[model samples]
Target: MRDCNIIKDLLPLYKEDLLSNESKTFVEEHLKTCPECENLLNEEIEIESKNTKPLDFVERRIKKETRYFTLAVLALIGSILIFIISYLNTPRHIEYDKDLYKVYRNDKIYTVEFADKVSGIDYTDTEDAIYLDAYSTKYDEIFNKRRLRKSLTFRKENLKTVLYQNHESMPNMVIGSGEIHQTLLPRLFLGFYARLSIIGFIGLTLILFLIEKFRKKAISLPIKTLLIGAPLSLFLGIIAIKGFNTATYYPVTDFKYIVLLSLGIYLFFIFISIFKEQKRM
Candidate 1:
């Protein structure tokens, strides 16, 4: 006869039909000869039958929730990456070399210089033009680092003619004297929209994380929070766009694209989370 302790330990496995065939045979044979063991096995089987469905259902739910949690994490990471790239690509400002341009006049042949200090400059002859415009090397370097290609546009004040710069590269530092602006680059832009985008990204992330943490409490709650996150992101994006429109530094076009990209990333995360939730359900 098998030991009672050993048989009792195997009773739960036998009740779930999880024991190997040899083990099942041993348990069955032992049960037949042992009345006490037989009663214990029967009781275990009855108890498992009563609670098995509920227990299985709970197990499956936990597994599904864990999967959804992983998906949420991936979605958040993706959105953050999108936001960063968009910000980097956005044109913050134009950089120029202030000391890079000079003009020399010789009766008929006026000499212009941007020798080696900048990429290039384009000029438009205008009436009442008293000065040559130039920028410094630091200006060009700053722009190069920011990823915005720079060029100069010369507009004649008297002639009312505007020249669009088409220089292939920064002009060499020029030798000559002209009235100059202290700096070609604007010092600060008061970037409203860019700030908004950052705030919105951070806020959305926090909200999503909190909602996901307690999602198991009520399935509908997380879904509702997701819905809120998307719209709030869009609303903030729009506000940021408005701020961009008013700001002098970043162009309106850049603001629009940045907002659109941020919105796309935010929506993508929310939709994916919702889709995974539905699948698990």
Candidate 2:
């Protein structure tokens, strides 16, 4: 234990206050005669002090950084939540049924029958409104017949009783006639958002997938795949659900849009994962 080599081996532990009493006394006794070993101990102490000071500084910097990062994350989350709420609650401009009726009664009505191939004014609504089948046709000189029937249904109530003479097209297009339907407005809005959400999601996923495949060996992802994926998935999912709720009137279109949107979101996550992995590398 009084050996100089033993004291050198224990120098690091001694500085750390981990030396046994016997080792401590042995090193102290040798240090009395060995100026070289004493100088070595002093040097070790200075190095340890410098190293510990930097570590403390680094630990404080990390703590400060973590605090700021947490605040930023919270603020971002709050903003997104507000945006979503505002979007969901925003009142949409929609044409009501009463407005449609008013427009119908004031506009000119043209009734065309498919079977009789006749356009007549006698196509008035009876006690039970007459249902008209209107179709478009193209004339073929070779066959001496009109071809290509694109038919649409119309209720007699949809017709406007008065006739208006105009040279330009109507300001608004009609679904069945020149009147607008209220039910379609919400559906259209929902369809638009659903399409946007779906596209964004898909783009994100594709990017992630490519990154993952190309940079698999290069880098580690900064965050776990699920950490980023879950949040993004939730965001897109909420958007799709909101769209579906609004588009309830048009279930088929809404459902189709939702499916597309979900797929797109999934792809986006894949891309995100890949990009993160690349960055880490």
Identify the leading candidate in terms of TM-score.
1
When summed lDDT is taken over every stretch of 10 residues in candidate 2, the lowest stretch is 132-141
Backbone steric clashes in candidate 2, count: 12
Q: Estimate each model's TM-score.
A: 0.43, 0.34
Best by lDDT: 1
lDDT tens digits, residues 76-154, model 1?
6677776655554443322334544455555444445454544333232335222233222343444554433334333
Local error of candidate 2 at residue 188 (angstroms): 0.6
Cα displacement (angstroms), candidate 2, residue 16, comes to: 15
> Model 2, 179-249: lDDT tens per residue?
52221112345556556655765676677777778988532343344434544554465464553445443
- Candidate lDDT (C-alpha), each: 0.52, 0.46
